[model samples]
Target: MRRLLSTTLGQILAIIGCSSVATFLLFIVLLSYFGSPPAPPWPWQNAYRVAGLVESLRGAPQDVRNTIVAAVRRPDLSVRLTSSPSACSRQTLDTHDFDAALRAELPGITDLAVRACTSHKPGETIQVLVPLDGQTLEILTDRTSGEPGRFTGPFYSALIFLCVGVAAMSAWAISRVIRPLRQLSEQADAFGREMSIAPIEEHGPLEVRRAAHAFNLMQERIMHSVQNRTRMLAAISHDLRTPLTRMRLHIETHRTDIVPDKLIQNIDIMQSMITSALAFLASDTDRETREWLDLGALISTLCDEYAEGGAAIRYDGPEQIRFFCRPEAIRRVLTNLVDNALHFGRTVTVSAKVLDGAIQVDVSDDGPGIPEDRLRDVIEPFVRLDHARNDRPGSMGLGLSIVKEIVQAHNGTLRLINRHPSGLTARVSFS
Candidate 1:
């Protein structure tokens, strides 16, 4: 029930409940206003009592009729009682009783009541005329004076029917009021799923329309910025390749002595750096067509190539561990880490572990662990700790930086920790 009340139907019911209570209270007040008598002394019931000084009073015994009349004259009083000594007289007046007696008459009462002013004296036998046929009295008691009063029956009936109609209309009005808001909620969910839901039409109330307009503008701006950045990266990568090709050709024709050999090595390093940088930048902007590749086989091939060249590299993990990744980009990142490990520590250990929806690759070597404060600085582009650089050769300081960038592009994290056996542990996690 609590959950139901939180839904749209419950909102409609809430509005109806409140409105019905208010309307019912108002109807009570209105009925009271209509039932009130015009005169004073407050005719809350059918009868009223007023005291006046005795006028000329009259009285009579039962056998003989006597005459008596009231001395006071008030045009508005429906019945006037005049008292005379020894006799009393009665005469017809107005029809206040018919209206007063309405509450006692349930179901149907179509008569207007008559008022008879009676005159009598105290301590005397009073004689008054009584109708013989009882026809005049009956007609007067049920005359139904003016137009029939409907406040007790038809008026309330109409009010109840009208109120029910209004409640139904109000429910529809509430649904109409919230329809735009529901659409906004659906659009937000779609955006979470695709980040590309079309903006809703600006309609409904002021607040809703403004929200729709703002969302549309934000979507357009994000799409524009992403397109512009991807285009700029593509242009830069295209322009860098021409100069790289020329440098490779120029170094190839004259690289034989030690100086030439060093230049060619530097150029080769520069070419590899450019290629990896381009791959990292292009990964997210243009998703690669994925294929099945044995991760263990890939790692083994690299380790074997380095082993044949006399590097202390070993693949110490599952022989057939397979995973999907952008092959060229991931290869470059792994290659950079393994090369850095072997260069600095002279021995590299490669291992893989699967934990909690992610694959972790740990590359550790028994060189000097990095200083704790310089861990963050080493991942910055072109940043080399002076001590680490002086301890090693062929280190351009870009290897770990490139590794971090490539891991980030795969929506992964890279961490550098000091190994327990006195080496740096580089853990790369791919999800």
Candidate 2:
């Protein structure tokens, strides 16, 4: 019940039910207070008329009684003088508006009876008795057949139609309000997953339209900020390259005698680091279009290339599995992970498998894995483990960072885990 009330349809239905009931109750109150506009004269009114006419004949001459009987009598309504009162005494009459009207119109009369009865001649009739000069006067008229009150048929149909129309209009308006919000939520998620998502359409109620417009502005600003940062980094990397090249030439021409071989190696490593950093920054700005590609084949080809280069690498998993992604970005991610594994460990094993509607690619190596505490830290730029600080040459510690960036750009996750018993595992998963 609680869950039902949470939905739009449920709330609308509840409103319709409550409003309809309230409206009906209001109509009932109005009817009770004002009553139905004067209907045809009631049976009791006819009976009262007969009583008034009969009283006129009381103690009158016989000729006057005969004349009134003839004047007031008709086929559907009749006035008669009878000797017996047994017919009116047999049945009890239900009190209604007619009874009240009769009492108000005939206040002085003491003995009177009004009842409904069926007779063979008339089928149904109202019998009235009035005491007239010691003789019981009987006035019988055709009973008024109850024509069901006005609040029926078209009246109820119109009410139902009105309620239905109100509910329908309310639902449409609510949906119009909710649809844009739902679209905004979807666009927000898409923006998080892919930076290139289009802006939300600004159309709804005033507040919702304002919110959408604000969201679009925020997205534009974020993209602009990232692009500006990337451009600045690229320019700095390019400027540093010219000086580094001139320094290399100077060292070769004159400083060779004084500079140790390690000094030259350090210069080379710095150049490599500069190149890698430039590449890292440039990758973000790459307008690489995405397409469906066979992920298994991509991993297999990477492993094969490493094997051709005499690296101890092995490939595992299905032969082919197509997935939508940026191919170059994914290739770079896989290449970085594979190169890192080969550098740190003796042998590398690349594998891919489908799990829970996503593709999971695992690159495992028989190397000393990162400590649990440092696993997250290692993925940040320029973060190197204590062991790799001196031993690994030309290592700027940006390989895993680049890998993480690319994976996240594809809306995927990259994590480094220590394998059971031995070795480190780099797991990249994408849906």
Candidate 3:
């Protein structure tokens, strides 16, 4: 219920309802103050006039009564001599206004009363009583002479139509505002999944357009920075390769007895590191197009390749599960995570499953897991925990870093957690 009220539709409805009620009440107050200019005299005024005429004719002769009755009688109104009071019920009468008007118009008359009663027709009729010297005179008037204490049918119908029209207009204006915000949110989500998404259209109200414009500018700046960094890395790689090549040629020319094997191995390691660094940096300069692929099959293929190489790698997942992603990038990420697991553990397990609208892939190993404190630090580029953990040859520590970047590019998350009793588990999840 709270969430429902917080929505845009709920707020708009609340505003419309409150405003309509307030405006209706304000209109009633104004009408009462100024009064209905076009409306005829109220029921009380008509009753008072008839009562005054009757009071003046009190104690007059029968001839005088007949003459006055003939003058005052009409199709909708009549005055008559009666020995009993009016038969109409007093419950529905507006006695306050009726008695006040009667007192103002005929101060000498007392024991006055007024009532509204149903007639043979569809509408109500007013009954006014005035006591004479020894008899009671009755006055009956048309329905229009009494106020019903409620708005007329037409008035209520018009009020309803006004409220509905105003509500529709409010909904339209609110939708216009909310539509742009919804578009902006969708664009942001797309950019998170793929940085190459087109810029958001600068439209709608001023605030929305300004936000879109700012987002586009920020995206351009980030792309520019990435491009600049990739170019610098490429230049550095080219400049260093020439000197390394020269040193290699010079070593080959020297005698083997003087130049140790370990020294040559060191130079080869440096070349391999340079190559890996260049590859990693170059990946940032290119955009990978995403496509739907079988994620389970990809993981199974990686497991098969490793098994063929005599590694204890097993896959536990469905036969095929399709997902949209950059195939090559995801493949590289899975390969690196599997290789890293194999390096520390004798047995490596790769598994995939769909959970909560997302795809989760887990790579687990039976080796000693990384320390809890160093879990976050190990994913940083060139970060090595060789001093604390087993030192593997030719490991530059770029594997996990690359995996993190690829997973993030797909709007996914990667987490490394120590397994119970022993080993480590690396889990990646993406929607």
lDDT of each structure?
0.60, 0.74, 0.75
Model 2 poorest 10 in a row by lDDT? 89-98
lDDT of 3 by residue, 300-326 (tens): 988999999999999999989889889
Q: lDDT ranking from best to worst?
A: 3, 2, 1
Q: Candidate 3 lDDT (Cα, whole model)? A: 0.75
- Where in model 3 is the C-alpha error above 4 Å? 1-264, 284-286, 391-394
Q: Can you write out model 2's per-residue Cα lDDT over 213-269, one digit (the tens) per residue?
A: 999999997986677466546545654565467667767777766556645665777
TM-score of each: 0.44, 0.44, 0.44
Off by over 4 Å in 1: 1-105, 110-273, 276-286, 289-293, 322-329, 355-358, 390-398, 405-412, 420-422
Highest lDDT, which number? 3
Clashes per candidate (backbone, < 3 Å):
17, 0, 1
Error of model 3, residue 154, in angstroms: 50
lDDT string, candidate 1, 1-431, tens digits: 78868988787778797888799779777645545333422222222211111111212332222222232232332222223212223322123333343323321323323234234222111122212122111111112133235365778788888888788888787778778888888877777677656777788889888887887787776765565456545644554565467666766777455546655665665566556455434545226655666777888899999999999988887777667667877888889899778877879999986777578889889988788888888886545676764533334345676688678877889999987767898999988
CA error at residue 290 for candidate 3, angstroms: 1.7
lDDT of 2: 0.74
